[model samples]
Target: MKTDNSNIDDLREVLHWIRNLVTGRLKIHFSQIDDYLVENIAFSEETTGLASFAITHQPTFIEFAVLALSYVPHIQPDFFNKIIAEYLPDGGDFPEFGCVKGTNHRGILPTGETAQFIIAGDDIGKRIAVQRLFSSEHWFAKEHVLWLEQVREGEPAMSGRMIMNPEIVELLTLGTVSKPSFSIDFPAEHIETEMDWDDLVLPETTFRQIQEIEQWIACNETLINDWGMKKRIKPGYRALFYGPPGTGKTLTAMLLGKQTGNEVFRIDLSRVISKYIGETEKNLARLFDKAENKNWILFFDEADALFGKRTDIRDAHDKYANQEVAYLLQRVENYNGLVILASNQRSNIDNAFSRRFQNIIPFPMPRPEERLSIWKKTIPQQLPLDMDLDIENIALRYELSGAAILNIIQYCSIQLLADTAPFLTAEMLDAAVRREYIKEGRIT
Candidate 1:
């Protein structure tokens, strides 16, 4: 079944009311003319139910819109034509000079230069009109559509409609709602992890770190709304996940996002880093600007490449690199949400950068018992195992990371699948282990 988007229709209904009210005002003001402007209500009953909704939600909004739209000719003439063309179709005519009426003008049309001049010209009258209309509803406190500047295409321009901000417009027209609205677009893969908290295999201390962060996320609202304001500490949480590849850094990030119910974005450092001066900051600012207010986690994987220790200022490149690092650190510190930075080498990250993080959890190579558990979990227990198969012995003998063990299992499983009696063999397992070591140049 298709979902009915009532927000769109409710908005159109409100537009109809504004069109009605504005046209009614036009008819009264221009009553001396023989052919007074009128509106054609071509919209279906299902689409535009009545003017009751706008009166309840935004009574002064339409009145202000009428006043604001008068300036549309000055700022957005093309947009104004697009709006009025609906009532006064391309064939319809509204004369440039006195007393000429549109043949198809069903309602009062604000299409003439006179209407534009009158609306734009009356500075004092407009002020009094604003005060008269919104005496009860404070105009300054309201989120009026006339003020917000949105990008028309690639450049910034004001979208002259209420509740039709760029984000909502994208949501209505396109399926996806663009975040931040700073960069033309963002390049980040949204990852959904299949691994849960229970599937993770790491040291007890590291697991405790995960628990602490999880509890913090769960109590984040309480901390901010209840405790954080009292203490004056920032609400954002920053953590560093450092270890060798395949020791569960990425999986932990994925699981954290899944657990928190907040959307996670993994930054692409390649795109963010630029050779030109100030371009890097511009891109970073755009990303962070969009990220603000939304409770989203930003995962910076392979972050050592960007947040590494500052080099001696022997050259311009070195100076800029340090500046880039400084810029990133400042943004992270100011951001009011969770940021997880993962790196293979903790030493590569500057002490200044490292100090900002609340937790610096180490993901060491899985110990023998943990490796045994990882091995067991990688394959289903229901799969037949040979009498010689021993995950514990394999775990003890080979100093393989959690990732390496999975790779070895995959290698042996594929080879066994082609055999007459498919089952794990000690010889096959040993061969796979040796192959993995050789592949990594550890046993070459």
Candidate 2:
């Protein structure tokens, strides 16, 4: 992974400044400290890596110092020790420096207090201002860039270790942030499809509504930012995609991202909705915090599990469940990008969420014509059908979803390979369709 030289230089300069500030404070060189406070760190204009990030955010000198401090441990493991060793050569504990040794790492890890000491020293007013950098209102926290970790119940907030978001660390170090994988911390999977819009067969009404969503993706920034509608309009677009299973709801969401050049993440509700009180919200917070500024499409599949209608307050569990719905509503409303909630039925969603949606699109089971279109598009050109096979009659007779059609095709293809058959006979097709009908508990 080749990093930009400019980013390396910028990081080196910030580290050097940290060293100078620490040395000046320890040596009681008040004039040097004053001079350093007045001088701003110069950064390169080259817009590729970490230098570009700094330039874009335009952080204050103190903020930049803290950002660099949080990142130093990851890159230069012994940075703080090297600085502290110069003064206290015997290496006694320096409480004012405010650092803790990691359990696995022998090197010193800077805490929020360490940031205060380097930037503010014994100055009480400056130290108070340093606390703002870690506050929730700060862009650092809002953007999931950097923050102080939570400490024990009784411990001071500043005593918590200074932590930078792992994605930010990767972005600065590798010049790109990799797409996050599905895990407990992030209960979402990156979803995409190679299939084009033309490949997706839908009823005319549903197709038009989908196109409207595409229009929003294309023109939303212009409406909010360029047209001066920021104050009047919500920053985000929320849509509800409700339909029966295997009816192209997920495919439409993926296509929206594909057509509009946005990344789509499907939240795994199974992992998100926890049995314990407040755990669900915590999981959601972790998800939303990471997704805050990134213009990614968030698709909540089978969302009724998390966004179901609030039940009447019968007990503590019921009350908390309602509260969770309320919290999710707030988060969804505030998200600046596209949020799509998918459900088997629209009525399953809470009225609170339903009212907030910009569009409520229904993906009904495909009509005969649409099913025929799907069939024509789905069958491989290389796999010839038997002369007696009537695909039109099959499409008209079976009330199947686009997904079910694909499944039937897959089953027939496998059977063809198994029997060393060159063509798909009506018998093979009928057997595959019957298998699908049986799976759905429908009479064959």
- Which candidate comes out best when scored by lDDT? 2
lDDT of 1 by residue, 1-444 (tens): 111454345445435544454454444444533233333323232332222223334434425454334332322335334444554576455443111222453333232233332232235565455434323354421323222222257631212121223442333223235544213356455666877888889999999998888887888788778664736776589999999988998888889889888778888888888899988888788677657667788888999888888889999989988898999999999888889999998897889988888899999988889988898888766456789788789888888887888898777767767674478878778888999989989887
Work out the TM-score per prediction: 0.71, 0.94
Give candidate 2's total backbone clashes.
0
Which one is best on TM-score? Answer: 2
Worst-scoring 10-residue span by lDDT in model 2: 29-38
Clashes of 1: 8
Per-residue CA lDDT of candidate 2, range 210-265, in tens? 88888888888888889999999877899999999999999999999988888999
Name the weakest run of 10 consecutive residues (lDDT summed) in model 1.
Answer: 156-165
lDDT for model 1: 0.64
Q: Show pairs that collide, candidate 2.
A: none
Clashing residue pairs for model 1: 37-107, 37-108, 38-106, 38-107, 38-108, 39-106, 39-107, 180-290
